[model samples]
Target: MPATSALRKAKLTVTISGDVINEIDEIAKEKGNPRSQVMEEILRDWLLKSKKMAIEKDIEAYYISLTENEKKENREWSMIATESAKRTWND
Candidate 1:
């Protein structure tokens, strides 16, 4: 499906806990928005944070998977680049 089509609003009938519904209602009242809008905003924020954490975990895994030799090489390359920069700036 097209991304836009997937993003299009659709109504869902869900059974939410009473306590959760009350919290949503409170947020709606505080923000002067409908319960659905408050829920959507909360869900969007949660999804974004989840995606960021997943990406961070993936990056950490990638670094952890590198061999010791590869890590040493990467450190050496970084040191060389730093030295080159320092020389350029001093001259």
Candidate 2:
């Protein structure tokens, strides 16, 4: 993770369960970082995971929308690509 100084700061408050807060604090202490820094990393990871899931969902929908003929063509192309990779690797 980048230094906190490299990023703009936004101050906000939210209520969390005591147990969760304790866990966050423990992790922060172990890492020699502040609670806010730990929280920032957690939120960043969550946002990245959400983005990846959204992209996956979009790709799934696109594949689902393809016609049978288009699907077959894609499979044929994939096989060709795989064979090409195999030949290249065997050389």
CA RMSD, predictions in order? 3.0, 3.5
lDDT of 2 at 27: 97
lDDT by residue for model 1 (1-91), tens: 6788888899978999999999999999999999999989999999999999999999999999999999999899999999999999999
Candidate 1 stretches with Cα past 4 Å from truth are: 1-4, 80-91
Where does the lowest 10-residue lDDT sum fall in candidate 2?
Answer: 1-10
**Model-by-model lDDT, in order?**
0.96, 0.98
Q: Residue 19 of model 2: what lDDT?
A: 100
lDDT of 2 by residue, 1-91 (tens): 9888867698999999999999999999999999999999999999999999999999999999999999999999999999999999999
Which one is best on TM-score?
2
Clashes of each: 0, 0
